[model samples]
Target: MKLAIQTSSGDYALGLIDGTGQLVNAISRAPDTAAAKNIGTLYSALMQKAGKETSALTGVMVDLGPGGLSSTRAGVSFANALSYGANLTLTGVSALEATMLDAKRKTDRPILAMRPSPGGACFWAYYEAGHSVASGCEAPDQLFSRLATEGKAFALAGPLRRIGTEALRATAAEQIDIPAADLACFAKTTPILPITNGTLTYLEPITNMDGAHHIAAKDLAS
Candidate 1:
């Protein structure tokens, strides 16, 4: 079984995936009130309710967020510690990618994935036929203008508030609301946070920074 944790969202989630039987158990909690301080508490509770032990986890999956900062760090730091201490494999999944996967289920057409970025612009990615064609951060007007130039229609998906769905309304695009459980089940992977960094400093430095900065997952993964 794999332990999947998603702290990227305002509401966090934990998932247990049993590949042998393709069985999954997903639990969602609002970190604001549920278990924000110590993710270990939440992890322990999930294990207990699922009748499993920490030893049962073959890998720890965490969401590398363009979502919440604190929550993202909480999940990553906790999973990183468990991965190092338990000798478990660590995998990181992107919140945007997971949202796109969730969007793909509802529509056969090309999907537009968006997430809030540091600037006023949003992190946007276009997926066609299950492959990402273009991805980057762009202002809403500029993005809309570009889409207009191409004359392509798309099904929009992501956190509406963060990405500002109002910009998508003119095209009459369909909005997708993917639950945390759905996103948790979507990731079956990670960017590989080096287990060496014994603190949470990396979490601040690594914020869905796009390709502009290098992610040392491969180099640091021992």
Candidate 2:
């Protein structure tokens, strides 16, 4: 049995899949912050629903994120701990790569993935012919205009769909929600990290500021 966890977005989900990447059951919930506290309860509940124990898991999967820092950290931390504890195989999933995969489910047209950055401009990645072409940020006031100039109709998928679609002034032909249970199924068939190293992927640098004030706040939070 395979278990998957995704906290890369506001919607957190736990998914289970069989050896053939078939979904057994999945659950989702949205929590705005402090994902660290309740993930254990959620995981236990899901396992109970599946009538399985955590040790029954043969492999584990997680979304190594470019989303909210705390949520992503909590998920990865949990996956790492579980992998280290149970000695189960683990793999990391990239949200952008998944977006490209989801886009390919339809027409073979080019794909554009955009995720909102910390400031104003969005982080963008593109794929064509089932391969990445380029990835960068959209120029100021040109997020929509740049796509218009691409001269080819493109499919869209990612966490930033709502804001990105609004900026485009056009409706998306396709927008994939990360919480979709099938993502876990697809991960089974997809090439993944051969071993779990407990590392994570981040589009924007993951940093903990160091200073007296920063340390004080972090300590207090802890």
Candidate 3:
């Protein structure tokens, strides 16, 4: 069994995935309190619901997000500590990458996985044929303008905000939601890379930017 956690988007979730990459059970809740405090309760409840102990887990996965800074940090920190204490393998998956993986299963068109960012900017990634082509952070107007100019059909994933509606009109984009269960499913196959450097992925920069610059994951030390 593998444990999966997601706290990005200011929502917290814990999932138990069986060896077959199928979700056995899950628990999700809105950010009613600090993730640091709530995660333990969720973890306990999830394991109880699944009728399994931490020792039963062979690995752990977390969604590295550019969504909510405090929430993401709380989740990642918890995941790192749990994996370390339990001597289990740890793997991190970008929410954007997982969204792309989910979209590819339902559509063949190019995909744009987007999440709202701080300072009116947006975190986005473009994928074609199961591979990432381009990604960046920018305001909605600017991003949609670039997409409109490209004139390519895109299937959009993640939350559907007002900007998402405009993206549909501007680029005729299709909206899709990447469910938490699907994220857990995809996470089972994501590469098993331990986050040994005490660094999270592609989040701090996006959430902390001043809306004047864009940063990529590669720009940061792994």
Instruction: Write the number of the candidate with greater TM-score, choosing between 1 and 2.
Output: 1
- Model 2 TM-score, all chains together: 0.74
Model 1 Cα shift for residue 175 (angstroms):
1.9
Candidate 2 whole-model C-alpha lDDT, 0 to 1: 0.61
* Per-model TM-score versus the true fold: 0.82, 0.74, 0.81
lDDT of each: 0.66, 0.61, 0.69
- Across residues 29-107, which tens digit of lDDT does each residue of candidate 3 receive? 8778644367888899899998889999998788767677778888877888888788887777677777777777888
Show how many residue pairs clash in every candidate, following the order shown: 2, 0, 0
Instruction: For model 2, state the Cα shift of residue 114 in Å.
Output: 2.2
Stretches > 4 Å off in candidate 3: 33-37, 162-170, 178-181, 197-222
Q: Please give the TM-score that candidate 1 achieves against the real structure.
A: 0.82
Local accuracy of candidate 1 as per-residue lDDT tens digits, 1-222:
888778877687787877652437766677767464667777777888898888988977777666667778878888777887888877777676677877877898788777766667776667777666667666766777667667676787887655554566665667785534264444532254543465432323236435433232111111
lDDT of 1: 0.66
Estimate the Cα RMSD of every predicted model relative to the unseen true structure: 6.0, 9.3, 5.3
At residue 51, what lDDT does model 1 achieve? 86
Superposition error at 15 for model 3 (Å):
0.5
* lDDT, candidate 2, 1-222, per-residue tens: 878877766678887878777778777777654543588877887888888997789977877655566877888778777776787787776555666676567557777665555666655556777665666554424655655554556776666443544555464445554333245534633444533235532222122222111111111111
